[model samples]
Target: MFWASVGFVGCILISLGSNIVRKTVERILTAQVIIMWFILLICVFTLTSMNDWIKFFKSLVENFGKIPPDISWWTLASAVCFIGAGGISNIWYTFWIRDAGFGMGSLIGKIPGWRGKKTSIKLSGYLPKPTKENMRRVKSWISNLHKAFWLVFFLMNFLAISLFAVLSNVVLHRRNLVPSGFEIAVVQAEIFQSVAGRFGYFIFLFMIAMLLWGTQLSICEGIVRQLADTTYLVSRKVRKFVKRDIRKWYFYLFILFAVWGMVWIVLQEFFSELIKPDFFLFLSANIGLISQLISLVMLLYFQYFIARKYLPKRLWDIYKPHPIRTVILLLTACFWGYFVGMAWMEKLGLLS
Candidate 1:
């Protein structure tokens, strides 16, 4: 049943991936209803259990600025990486910005749907002329983009994470119950029910399922687009073969990924003894770290090489990189790189 459920999600995600961005956005917006319910649930949970909140705060004070012994380096790195969009996830924002016709991204055409009459797009787009008016507009658009990301994306994400952390600390940590596996939902549901009755149990489960579905769909869409875009850009032969319909490549790659996942599931079932749970945990952690490192490198390369070299000098006044931001990124990249190397060493049994 567990495997079937996983497969079911994969099927739906691929189906969505094959569709237009609008369809995916519609589903995402639908799933966002869960967030409203979550807010309500948390408010009720807090109001009903003021003592729990008090205890949670006290515990936070007690353990302030100290890492627990059982907490691993891998855990810390994963948290740092994932507190916002981790790895190549933020790269997908570029795709979205282009599709939404932000700034110079307006010149690049979006990925068309399988059913659309607008089915072809240029692999490369024309550059906007370095006109003063265009530069001003571009700067304004970029400023709005920054505002949207920091104000909407970052703030909402921080709030959601804060709420969930409070809930977990108040409920699970207080009871010394660690959340793990499929049964984690059931355990969480029980906790919610204790505060808000039977309806809360069902609400919790529904919200969790919605959250997971949104995440799975997002991964499917982002990765398929990333792979298809990269292939079309990098390989002239691939571009020649596909002509201009990268949508087919996106759909095909999604199917391929789904098949790969199914095969892994089968292998896990067959080699259940050999493939221990810790192996999967470490595998996930390592993949996250590596992807984060890759993204960091790409970001630096873009800032230093691509943007600095390719962008018109006349436009540099309006769109130059911020020194403080660049410095912070470099420092964070170094910090994450160190932890990633340590994680790899520990995984390879090199750590004494």
Candidate 2:
């Protein structure tokens, strides 16, 4: 608990320091993600046993229906729902990209908190009239955004999740060990120890700490940005409170969020016992599933209706998703929607 508290405080400090300088925050997160990938690579090569992989595959083929009785369907559903940022965290990408000065985001000013000089843009929400040159620029920006999405978001997450799946199956599952609560990090660290000795355990611990630190920092920064942006966009009266300085609003939100998190941590045991188990599971899985469903609808609507209608013909031709891609997106959405419906029915005692 002490170490967790220390790590949490360290993350909050990093976030507070870097909140003003977007580049610094980006660099810190990017560096930690890269380092984590390297650590995963080391563990894959040195720690995982080939025999365990064989057993894992064999079990999948021969005992596919044998899910552990202790693991509820909601647990599996929640894991699946989180695949490839299909949860609320998926929206954080938009926040990061906008603040990083992508597309129309370039026209809007950024919140320069404490570490950076304040910047102001003459045009707040307006975009310059679309000319052929502007259309071409927009197309280029969209293309670049696609590349970044695939490389940075999709591929990295795929590789990281795959590595952990392999580690779990080969190192932990083979021993009938399950990571629960505080044991999650410890179990993962043991994988390194098993292969490389006590030193590897320490290395893995450091890796875990660094990863958590980066994640918490990013979460804090992203949530504050989202809240401040939403508030500024939605309510004029609330907007007056910040005096048009998003930095001030962000800081206020960050402080509130920090206090809330600290209080939750301090009274976690009491809350844990007060909240029903099923209720927590329902929130974890269904809320994220609903968010993903909404995101998919908004994405499809933007692509098929808004973009197609507003974009220049040439630019639309260049940037529009291919028919196959659209079909795939629709299918994916439907698949998740089905699972979400089933989960909801089951939760409501309407389904067996």
Pick by lDDT: which candidate is best?
Answer: 2
lDDT of 2 by residue, 1-352 (tens): 4665675576556655764546778888889988887887888888667875676567667976555665555665677676776577778777777777888786677766565554443224545456878778877888898898898778988778767778777777768887776587898787668778998898888888887777667767777777877886777775677666666667778778877766666666467787554555457667788788888889999988998998667767766888998998899788778778767776678866
Model 1 Cα lDDT, one tens digit per residue, 167-270: 76766777899977677878978988887798878877777776666665666667877888888778888767876677667667777877766666677778
Candidate 2 error regions (>4 Å): 49-71, 119-132, 270-272, 275-282, 311-315
Q: In candidate 1, which residue ranges exceed 4 Å CA deviation?
A: 1-19, 26-30, 33-65, 269-271, 276-278
Model 1: which ten-residue window has the lowest total lDDT? 10-19
C-alpha RMSD of candidate 2: 3.3
